[model samples]
Every structure is written in structure tokens, then in C-alpha cells.
Target chain A: DQQVKQNSPSLSVQEGRISILNCDYTNSMFDYFLWYKKYPAEGPTFLISISSIKDKNEDGRFTVFLNKSAKHLSLHIVPSQPGDSAVYFCAASASRSNTGKLIFGQGTTLQVKP
Target chain B: DTAVSQTPKYLVTQMGNDKSIKCEQNLGHDTMYWYKQDSKKFLKIMFSYNNKELIINETVPNRFSPKSPDKAHLNLHINSLELGDSAVYFCASSLTIGTSGAYEQYFGPGTRLTVT
Candidate 1:
């Protein structure tokens, strides 16, 4: 079973515009949500994250909003740049599990048009 | 310097062959993990080691084995490789496994394995 799901397979946005990527999870036990950006042939790099206790977390141009009631989270990038084009993966983990195991969603490919 | 490094960035082998992928982290982290990304872009955890001890082992095949000789190194060895084994494998490291959300994983440039 896919605990986490990214309904959209791909997204396209223009540079200098806002881009949003959405993710949903079936497991309410997940306490932490994270986003990673991956370039072709490279490993995923951390982007932003939000805890279950917080509704939103912001890191510069990247912002993550979490809604525990809806079991959903989203990553928003304002004024998207061409360099922001890459695959974005949504991941979640139950921190208390101690194993640090993460359940990841099928990644969403973001294309920022220059 | 690379935080996590994997040797043999690309491996192409025939079915029924045996191959190993070596991973090392210089970040002085206490936890290391192995993840596999298949053609569908699904990143799944295969194994995790903390301080040279196995912490988590997913329901992977018996043909796949993970060895952590020390805290900084974790290696994956595959025996009798199958066609389904072709994918990109990633090695990652984190400071600790806790509920504090400080455990951000840093990943190495992945090793692409193609089995024919």
C-alpha cells in the first residue's frame, strides 16, 4: 500500500510565478513531513518540512503547509525560477518509530518555464 | 568534500552475476540508510544501520544483503542479480534517529545499476 501519494505526476509553471505541489497521506501516525528536490542523475536534496504540530513552515522561497485534519501537505515556491525545475518528492516518517524509516510518494516532476 | 560517496557510480552486469555497491559517509553521522528508486520514481527504503548495527530491514529479497562494517560505511551486496534489480540505489546518512525532526537525511550521488 502507498501510504503517501502525490496525485499529480507533473506540473508546469512560468518563472516568476507561484508553483504549488501537493501530497496526501493515508497514515495519520506520521508526525513529520518533508520535501526533497532531485535533479537528473543526482540524489534527492532536502527542501522544506513541517511537523504535525505546525500548520506551516517557511524556508526562504520554499514554504510547506501541513493540514493534519486533511492528511495533506503542500510545497509552495513563489517566484519560481528556471533552476527550480526538478522532481519533488514528498516523504513522511513516524519519528517515534526510532528506525527513521520514511514513506515516500511517487515524485512530481516540476517544470519551470524560462 | 562529498558528505556521502558511493563507489562505481554506474554498474552494468548480466543476469545471475554478483555485484556490490560500496557507500561511505564522512559526516560523522550515527545512522545510515539505503534507498532504491525504481523506474516509477518510487523511493523505497531497503535497510538502515545505526552505529554498525542493523536497525531496520525492509521486506527485501534474501539475495540482497547489507553490511555495515563501521559507523561510517554501509555496503550492499546483491547475489544472482535479476532483471528487476536494475534501478538507482542511494546511500544516505542522518545525525540520529529521534522524534525531534532534526534527522534530516543527506544522500549521496546515486549509483545506477543496469542488469541485462
Candidate 2:
């Protein structure tokens, strides 16, 4: 079963506009969530993350929002740039397990038009 | 210098063949992992090693075996590969498995394996 789900297969947005990507999880035990960006032929790289205790975390132009009650999380990029185009994956890990294993979503490909 | 590197970036073989993929990390991390991304673009963890010891083994098949000779190297050997084995495999490293939210993993350029 897919514990993490990124329902949107793809997304398109104009440059300098806001881009929002959504993710949902079925496993309530997951306490930490992270976002990774991957390009073609390259491995995924860490982007941002948020703890279940916090509602939001921001770094520069990227922000992550987590709603524990809804079991949903989102990544927001303000003034999106063409360079931001890539596949975005949402991952979660239950710290209690202490295995540091991550369950990843199906990934959403984001395209920014310049 | 590359943080995590995997040899044989591309592998093509027939079914029932055996192949090995080698991975190395120069980041001096104590933990290593293997992940597979299938045609549907779903990334899943297969195994994880910490300091050359097996820590996490997912529900992967017995045909897939992971060996860690040292903390910096983890290798995967697949026997009797099937059509379903065609996918991109990624090697990753982390400093340590922690309960803190600061844990982050660095990944290598994936190795794409095609089974005929």
C-alpha cells in the first residue's frame, strides 16, 4: 500500500508565480515529513521538511505546511522560477521506528514556463 | 568530489542473468541505503546499512542481496533478474539515523537497469 500519496501527477505554472504541491499520508505514525526535488537522470535532493508538531516551516522562497489533523502536507514556492521545474516527492519517516527509512510518494512533476 | 557515487550508471541484461551494482560514498556518513524507482516513478526503500551492519530490510525479494564491506561502501547483487527488475536504483548516505527532524540523506546519480 502507498502510505504517502501525491495525487497530482504533474503541475504547470508561469514564472514568478506561486506554485503549490500537495501530498497526503495514511500512516498517522509518521512524525516527520520532507520534500525532495529530482531532475531527469539525477537522484532526488532534499528540499524542505516539517515536523508534525509545527504547522509551517520556511526557507528562502520555499515553504512547507503540515496539517496533522488532515494528514496532509504541502510545499509552496513563491515567485517560482524556471529552474524550479522538476519532479517533487514527499517522504515521511516515523522517528519512533528509528530505522531512518523513508516512504516516498509517486512524485509530481512540476513545469515552470518562462 | 561527488558525495555518493554508483558504478555502471546503466546496465542492460537478459532475464535470468546476474549483475552487481557498486556504490561508494565519500561523505564519511555512517549510514547507507538503497532505493528503487520503478516505471511508475514510485521510489521505495529496499535496504539500509549502518556502519557496515544491516539495519533495515524491506519486503524486497530474496533475489536481491545487499552487501556492505565498510561504512562507506554498499553494493547490491541481483540474481535471476526479471522484467519487473527494470528500474532506476539509487544509493544514498546519511550521517546517522536519528529521531531528530534534522536527518537528511544525500543521493547519488541513479543506476538504470534494463532487463530484457
Candidate 3:
């Protein structure tokens, strides 16, 4: 079963415009959420993460917002650039378990058109 | 310097062959993990090791075995590979602190295995 789901398989946006990617999870036990960006033929790179105690976390141009009640989270990239084009994956881990294992979504491909 | 590195970035073998993949991390992290991305692009965890000790073993097949000689190295050996085993495997490392749990993990470039 896929505990984390990224409904949108692909997204396209113009350069310098705002890009929003969404993710949903069914496992409420997951307390820490993370976003990773991956390019073709490469491994995923860590982007940003948020703890359960916080609703939002921002790093540079990337921002992640989490809604516990809705079991949903989103990543917003402000003034998207062409380099931002890649597959974005949403991952979650339950800190209570402390195994460091992550449940990942199917991933969303975001394309920024220059 | 590469934080996490895996040997044989691409592997092609027959269905009944036995192969091994090696992974090393220079980040000095205490934990290492193996993840597999299937054709569907679903990334799943297969095993995790902390300080050379097995900590987490998912519902993977017995054909897949993971060995950790030290905190910085983890290896995977697969026997009698099946066609369904063709996928991209990633090696990752992270640091686990007191009660804060695991920090963000660093990943390698990934190894793509193709079974004929």
C-alpha cells in the first residue's frame, strides 16, 4: 500500500512563476516530512523538511507547508527557475519508530519553461 | 569528495546470476540504508544499518542479503536474480541523534541493475 501519494504526475509552469506541488499521506503516525528533488540518472537530493511541531518550513526559495488535520503537505517554489525542473518526491518518517526508514510518494515531475 | 558512493553504477546480468553491489559513505554518519526504486518509480526501503548493526529489514526477499562491515560501508548481495528485480538501487546515510531521531539522509548516484 502506498502510504504517501502525489496525485499529480506532472506539472508545468513558466519561469519566474510560482510552482506548487502537493502530497497526501494516510499514515498519521508520520511526524516528520521531507521533500527531495531528483534529476535524471541521479539520486534524490534533500531539499527541505518540516517537523510535526511546525506547520511550515522555508529554505531559500523552497517552502513546505503541512496540515496535520488534512493529512496533506505541499511544496512551493517561488519564482521558479528552469533548473528547478525535476522529479519531486515527498517522504515521511515516524519519529516514534526511530528506524530512519522513509515512506516515499510516487513523485511529481515539475517542468519550468523558460 | 562524494558523500555516498556505490560501485558498478550499471549492472547487467542473467536471471540466475549472482551479483553484489558495494556502498560507502564518507560523511561519517552512523546510519546507512538501501532503497530500491521499481519500474513504477516507487522508492521503497529494503534495509537499514546503524553503526554496523542491522536495525531495519523490510519485507524484502530472502534472495537479497545486506552486510555491513563497518559504519561507513554497506553491501548488498543478490542471489538468483529475477526479472522483477530489475530496478535502481540507492544507498543513503544519515545521523541519528539522542531522541531527535534521524536527520536528513544523503544519497548516492544510484546503481541501475538490469536482469536479462
Top DockQ model? 1
| Poorly placed runs, candidate 2 (over 4 Å) | B99-102
Give the distance in Å from residue A13's predicted Cα in candidate 2 to where it truly belongs: 0.4
User: Residue A30, candidate 2: how far off, in angstroms?
Assistant: 0.3
By DockQ, the better pick of 1 and 3 is 1
Query: Where's the lowest-lDDT run of ten residues in candidate 3 chain A?
Result: A93-102
Interface RMSD after interface superposition, each candidate: 1.0, 1.1, 1.3
**Model 1: runs farther than 4 Å from truth?**
B99-102
Model 1: which residue pairs collide? none
lDDT tens digits by residue: candidate 3, A1-114: 889999999999999999999999999899999999999999999999999899999999999999999999999999899999999999998887878889999999999999
Docking class of 3: medium
**lDDT digits (tens) for residues B31-89 of candidate 2:** 99999999998999999999999999999999999999999999999999999999999
The lDDT per prediction is 0.94, 0.95, 0.94
lDDT of 1 by residue, B33-110 (tens): 999999988999999999999999999999999999999999999999999999999999998787354558989999
Checking candidate 2 for backbone clashes, the offending pairs are none
- Give the TM-score of each candidate: 0.98, 0.98, 0.98
| Interface RMSD of structure candidate 2 (Å) | 1.1
